[model samples]
Target: MLVETVTLQIPEILYQRLVNTARATQRPLEEVILHALQTGSPPEWDDVPEEFQADLAALDKLDENTLWQIANSGKTSAEMERYNTLLEGNSSGTLTEAERLELMALRHEADLFMLKKTQAAVLLRWRGHRVPTP
Candidate 1:
């Protein structure tokens, strides 16, 4: 690609956002702004599964605090205990119909929770937050 220099003035809010991203990523402000311009979103949602695209896409509108809270959340201890028991029963082929249904519901809910958490982390990182791995 050929290099071209262009000068432009951006609003204060946009400039602050770019500066924040640059700081969080430990990169230059110009590089962060350039990446944002080229990729649209720092984190791409287009490649996510069709069923999850809408859910993930909506995270873009969330505030940083809310996204951070979500990124740090997890299933409750009680829920995890129950889910584990159900999973063990499933592996043993000893689950009753009601138990099986409950297990499936729990499994689906867990999947959704994990996906949401991952999306939230991605958004936080894109918005210049240091999202640590779980």
Candidate 2:
């Protein structure tokens, strides 16, 4: 594949960390950085589980307006309160079994929400909208 080179002004600490990671993994620095850029958070759906594929397909079907709405969706006030409560409990080492389960459920919900939002953003960009960087 043809490749283009671009210079980046990364922080010294970040650059060191990337170098360390590359050395530890026995991969070239450029390869490591390119891999990270290609497969960012909420990775491509090609190897995702079947259930997630369904969700991705659903998101792909949404119109631009609907995609915009999904992209802007965020956790409700109650959800935020619960998340805060869970964080407090975790910090105090006092999470009950039920609370732990609830926290896990909330985390799963947040992941799904983020996936939908990311997909929506990609769709909007595909439709020629100037989607802002997250």
Candidate 3:
């Protein structure tokens, strides 16, 4: 693919965070930035799974306040406990077939939720919202 170089004056704090991310991930800074630019927002509906289409559509309708709420939400305590239990079972080679499937489904849901939250954060940043750092 053809690529063009462009100059950007990134804020020092954001630049530091990007640099840190690149170092932690063992990726090139340019690659990290490019990936963020490409995937930080909601993807096209056609590119998403059929099961996620409705969720994505709902995300599309979220106001800034609602988006903020979604972006800040974390897994419930019950979800965390279940995840830990599954992890323990897997590590011990004792997970039942049903438990294995449950763990996989839970992981999938967590991944989807994270994707949505990230997209919401990107939207918030685009709208000039002051999102707090972790």
Better of 1 and 2 by TM-score: 1
Q: Would you estimate the TM-scores of all the predictions? A: 0.68, 0.61, 0.58
Q: Is candidate 1 or candidate 3 better by lDDT?
A: 1
- Pairs that collide in candidate 1 are none
How many steric clashes does model 1 contain? 0
| TM-score between candidate 1 and the true structure | 0.68
The local lDDT score (0 to 100) that residue 87 gets in candidate 2 is 80
Q: Count the backbone clashes (under 3 Å) in each candidate.
A: 0, 0, 0
lDDT string for model 2 (7-95, tens) is 88886644654564455446687875775577542224545556566686565445567778888888889889989999899889999
Candidate 2 vs candidate 3: the TM-score winner is: 2
lDDT of every predicted structure (CA atoms):
0.77, 0.69, 0.72
Better of 2 and 3 by lDDT: 3
Q: Quick one: RMSD of model 3?
A: 13.1
Error of 3 at 92 (Å): 1.7
Residue lDDT tens for model 1, 1-134: 99899998877655765665566556788887887887563565667668777776666556677778889997789889999999999999999999999998888777778888988898777665688996
Off by over 4 Å in 1: 1-35, 38-40
